[model samples]
Target: MLDKTLRNFDIPAFQQDLINWYQANKRDLPWRRTQDPYKIWVSEIMLQQTKVDTVVPYFQQFIEKYPTPYALAEADEQDVLKSWEGLGYYSRARNLQTAVREVVADYGGKVPDSPAALGSLKGVGPYTKGAILSIAYDQPQPAVDGNVMRVFARVLNIDEDIAKPSTKKLFEKIAAELISTADPSSFNQGVMELGALVCTPKTPSCMLCPVQEHCRAFADGLEQELPVKTKGKKQKTTTYAALLIKNEQNQYMIEKRAENGLLANLWQFPMAPIDEIGMEHITNWFFAEYGVQMNIGDKAGTLKHVFSHLIWQLEIFHAMTMQTETADERIIFVKPEDLRLYPFPVSHQKMLKYILD
Candidate 1:
């Protein structure tokens, strides 16, 4: 009997309820004012696995720097990453840069209106493409983000594992059915807003929920159970060694990372895996490679940064060095005051801040 109630759901009343709520309570976000695909694309990309408040400043700064797809394509990748500092998931920043290049070279710097064409661009995955089409172009496309998934699972009282790809397809079909063709952009925003503010993950404000009457989860007192999820794999941990070398003039030595891997193209103190490393080996490597000698200082502290799949346990050590020979190596010695000029990851920022204070 409960199972049957979960099936054969109707969405018109729910849609109306959400639309009404959004008309009055929607946030005055900058991205909501314009229908520009480029702005929409940038916001959606930045919003992935990130909160709205965190993304607002980044969006403003990125737009001020890039302004358009052609501008972003022509700018340096490091500059793009620099603007995206403090935002996790470095790949999204890289992909945004790559997508800009593709948009300029292939699509003449305009985002595609059709879903298939939008999806063809680099980093414009299904969810992103749907968002752009529906929100910017007013197309009746299904943007099935985590928020919408939660809303649909509870409204229909679905217990089918929401983690499955099939569940996404099912939700997409249902969303497309509920979307008001008269104003798809409004309808899409309404549903997304409902999920974000009303049907939140914990202690949902059901009193304010627009469609509480039609929600099967509300009736059965199973709002938390309807959107069933499978447990995800635990994050893997990795160790890092940072060599905090200081020169005779009280300046620190730092290097720019290659434009790949974690925290790509950012500046940081020299680092190597410490499990198979020793102080003697580091001293030898610096002298042989860069012709610099150093007296190892005491261990300053350790910092940890967590990414989606990997965890970094960074062990930072302080050392003093004097240059024996002047060579134009890839390393730069900068005073603490000038550290802000170069872009660095949050982990490195924290380390520098700690040492400075």
Candidate 2:
């Protein structure tokens, strides 16, 4: 099927047109300014499930702080999480740091140039590996991410469900074969850029597409229907109660999450499940965990945060601490202003806003 699909279009012309259009019209992103493997690696990791516009400032700030693999590897985990505060996917930051540490320890603090070496690092999957190789090293590798998949599906008029692993493999194969050996970097970026700006998911700008003449979906008037994807499983909603405990000096109590779970190593107001036992159970759990007695007060506010796999319905509660001395190392009491130094998940961040406001 892939061979037959290639036969229907002029491959050379398609590549040339796409590359020309990209070089002429590509967005002036910060990452595009340099072929530095470390910078490109950072940008690519941050770009996963995140928009380019949103990533720009984060990328700039992050690179300024941790300019090299050695810097990132040497930074504290909490500091790293703080640097990645609003980026949402905290694990990406953690995993990238871990991988960078490996690079420093084993690969001489340089991001590996070859595909195989880059791929062996933690969190460096196929797309990231290909991106690092093609964009940084100018290797003829295919980075078939969602945007690329969308572009290829429309260009080839493929109707396979993109959510399936098999579909991703097919797209990767097609991209590898189609990649321009002389300039894979621009070609891959062009494909993604075209998908992002012109061949949008809802309403593609067919007339403005550079490769429209060779696009199978354009010829068939089926651009919108070509990149088929199955719907994901429904996200489970879990109810939690976030406690804002104030000490005698008006300091708020916060706790760091366990090192190996969702939102790991991030700070948050002490929280407990809002189960059948209700606020009483939450209070009990808080006291048990932190060794601090709490006098629960009026409800402050409610905040909802949605992750990729679950929805958190957080109910905020104001409370006064009955005991100041708690031996738990994970728990800390700090003035409200001090909270700025810690990284809290968006849910807790919203609750903090209500407390401060």
Candidate 3:
């Protein structure tokens, strides 16, 4: 029955209904108004794994700060990371700047429109490439993101795990087949709009869906169970002792993270992982790392932060170095008011507020 329905699917009618609805109902987004490939690329990257409401203000400010590819490519990496401080995913900002620099130096300051050229950029993937090409260049490429996958899962009654790579490839092919050649931009955005607004993950508004009559899962009364996705592994937790050291100059001691690991280059107070909570062990570890013995005072506070793959349990303490000096270049002393100048991870940001207050 599924095969029969698939074979008889009226691709043109479905495309037309979806696009027409999108033309009239699609939200007015900043990136939707321009044909500039650069702006579109930024929006596509910012929208990844982030909600639209959360990305709007950030998008506006970023575009205003770095109006062109050259503007962003030439800006300091620290400034770029600062702009993206609260956005989580620090790598996205770093990769975006790297990609933009390539576009400026190699691509003549214009975002490449071809798949080969665009995909070679540091951060442009298949999904992002399709979006830029279809929207900026009017190409019929498919942007198969989570929203597209979910909508198509119900449309074709596909029970394949949406989390698998094979399912995405299948959906990409299906998207390519069903895309409206005449209006690829609207068709792609329409599918995304439908998934985001009408055909939501929970309690989809089937009656209001433009292509409700054509949805296979709705016909089979399996709208709620069509998209199968495997669960990801549980997040692992780690404990750390964060040191808040203040010197005679009224400056706080902070250190930059390693240049290659998680939260690379972001600023944070001196911290080291611990097996358990103990002031003695924490100070000893600090001494080993910095070659400066420190005194552990009263406990400032404790903070728990969650990431996509890991959880952090931070035990913050009021600490002071015996020598009152950090010799490492990565370590710096910043007055309380100047701490905001450096970009710190959310976990560290919370620590600063705790100790400062």
Candidate 4:
């Protein structure tokens, strides 16, 4: 039944068209060459919610620094976070490190080839597992990314709101059935490439499309109308941070963020919620938490940071402590030289320089 449906679908022509186009047009991405599941895994994770050009240098630098799972596992969290700086979604970096540790401990530092095993790794989701299994292990798994979603919707003339879960399942089922039986890597890359290059979300270059003839949307003159997406909820804006920095005797007082919030487990200058950052609020928080008296100094500056759902308008303050502090409770003072050994988000780092300079 599947074969019959595919026969009437011009599968060969579309496959050949995409394959020929890919042979001549696919970009020379480093991850495309090796069947190393580790390399492919890293690339796919970095590529999520990120662009290819951004992932390239990061991938190259990361692989150069930590060439193996064992190496990545042995790396300090600070070093790992530093490497992942500027690539937001800091949690992904933390999860990647956790996953490396798991791979080293359970799999003996060799990345698993099976989809089930790969999917079991920390931070390895359905799309990532599919990408690794197919691109690295030659498994006929369909990696459904946004590009693939768009391509499948247009190619099949699907209009059941691509945002719907049922629509996604239908696309995945069709993708698995249509997957090339040979060299799944090439086939997967061909689909991803066609979607990214020719059948883009907006202003698709249909005149240059390889499988335009097989595209039901193109045949119906609805290529621009397919893959209907429902509007998403507005990203709520909330502000909750104002970084505070204290520089004394070449040391900066920095605090480790809680392990669950944005940029968790990363170092930052002592920060309080926006509502708790005035002169009175800072003094009250310090007295309540540490029983220490502090003389609030000049306002160094404010740093504005944006997350996917929240915005932080941080007003940094400089201050001097009443006594030499020990690294005991919430805040710790570290020399500027030692500060380099810790990973601080850019927002905190910006405030640190304001005081250190």
Candidate 5:
């Protein structure tokens, strides 16, 4: 009886309650103001794994700088990365540019109104494809992201692990069946808004929820336990001794990262993986890596930055080099004032700010 009840929900009341609540209470996000697929695309991409408050200023500045796909496509990749510097997950920026360039070349600078055409984009996957389709074009497709999935898990009282790939399809299918054909835009956004606000992960405000009457988990007092997710693999930590090499000309030595792999094509201070941060170790590494000997100074500071699956523990030290000539094309010297022109990872940015301030 319990198993069958999960699938047998009041579809009309659920859809209507969500839509009516959302139409009346949805937050006035900047992205909600415009229906342009390009803006919507940019907002959705920026909002991935990021909080709405944090994305607001970045989105406004980004849109103000690059108003259209052609503007971004024609701009330098370094400049694009600079705009997305602290956003983390630099690959998303790279893939967005690649997809927009395709849009410019193939779709005449317009985002496609169809799912098949939009799904062919470089960074757009199943959820993104559905989001752009439903929100931008008002299609009845389901946008089952993590937030929407949480909403569905409790509303339907399902105990499947959301972290698994197979469970996503089940949620998507149910969402498709439950979506309002009259307003897919509101319906999808409503579920996302509900999850973010009322049906939150840890402590949901069940009494205030518009769909509280329709939530099986609320009735059974298991709202918090409905969306069962297995713990992800533990993050790997790597320690590094980063060199903040400054020359007499007020120019600092910064190196461009490799074109591929993690934080690809970004700029950073010279770093060497080592367990020690002594002056002798720093001097030897300087001569070995760049063939330029330097006077190692006091320890600048320590920084810890966390990525998706890796943590970088860095011990930064200030070093000076009178001889700045280097044979490595990847290495360049820039004044502290000009560091803004280069895109550094968040960890390096913090180190620089500490010294500069």
Candidate 6:
């Protein structure tokens, strides 16, 4: 049993306590040091599905390379993808460039301050829009991502599935109501900070949480079980044969993925699903695709890479070629030293390590 109605509680006191706790205890993240919309926007996008420590260096490099919306808009797409190499969900990088180009062309190179205008940009969803408006502009919009949702679920002792769209909407509404008008930036960030720090998904330190006194879940001793999320579908495994074809000169062969879909435009060693394609068929297909004859060698090794929806079980094979160039436009022969410049998916990166090391 969960209480949906707002009970008579010291909401103002709760807000002050949480904000005070945040002011004293929030981690000194680079993104927190600025109100620049461009910087904040970049940080918000990079933070998507990525951990803070992992995003820090990438964020610094990206900001240095493309300091403004105009700069990012003008840069090459491949270069942008290269800059975002290791950060998975490469679509985020592509969509970010698209949205920044829109801002430069349409919004006079300025990130829109209003929720509606920001939301209209490509890949700018409710959470992103709310983040920009509230954090950058100090607007009273709720940014209810997983962290905010978890905090609210526990504070209110909510029993609904947090994975549901309706549940997210409900949490967003409650967050909007709870946002401090005087300092929406700190308030919104404070909630997320609390969730990330004290009220963590596992082993939440309710005893240390600033809002513990007002938390219904804490009062009812249900903090651990409040924010119930349904388990996602199991990822389907797919087998792949990754070809590491090298020439006599030690240049490796790579190809650009198709313009659309997963890892689009990123460079990868020629690989194919191994369902119906056998070793002999693969060697022939390689010549057909790249117009370069290869001598297949010993099995290198195997690696497993997991994406959100699928699992890639890759079988690595070493091969040699006499030709140093490719007749196919999509394929390119690059020296081992130059491979670092091309953006490779983690799966291929691992394969390269197996070959090099």
Clashes within 3 Å, all models in order: 0, 0, 0, 0, 0, 0
Winner on lDDT between 1 and 2 is 2
lDDT of each: 0.81, 0.89, 0.88, 0.78, 0.88, 0.88
Clashes of 6: 0
Higher-scoring candidate on TM-score, 3 or 5: 3
Ranking by TM-score: 2, 3, 6, 5, 4, 1
After superposition, which runs of candidate 5 have C-alpha atoms over 4 Å from their true positions? Answer: 1-7, 276-282
Residue 18, model 5: lDDT of 92
Best by lDDT: 2
lDDT string for model 2 (113-145, tens) is 877789998889999999989999999999989
Model 4 earns a TM-score of: 0.90
Higher-lDDT candidate of 4 and 5 = 5
Q: In candidate 6, how many Å is residue 69 off? A: 1.4
TM-scores, one per candidate: 0.89, 0.97, 0.96, 0.90, 0.95, 0.95
Q: Per-residue lDDT for 298 in model 1?
A: 86
Which scores better on TM-score, 4 or 5?
Answer: 5
lDDT of 5 by residue, 1-357 (tens): 333644668888888999999999999999999999999999989988899999999999999999999998898899999999999888889999999999999999999988898988988888888889999999999999998889999988888899999999889887888899999999999999998998998989998999999888899999979799998998989888888888988788988999989899999998888865554576787787877778878788899989889899998888899866698888898888888889999888888875577
How well is each residue in 89-187 modelled by candidate 6, as lDDT tens digits?
A: 898999999999999888999899977889998888999899999899999889989999998888877788998999998888788778899888889
| C-alpha RMSD by candidate, in order | 3.0, 1.3, 1.8, 2.7, 2.1, 1.9
Point out the higher-scoring one by lDDT: 2 or 5.
2
Which is superior by TM-score, 2 or 6? 2
Candidate 3: tens digits of C-alpha lDDT, residues 262-325: 9988999988888654555766667767766768778898999999999988888886654556
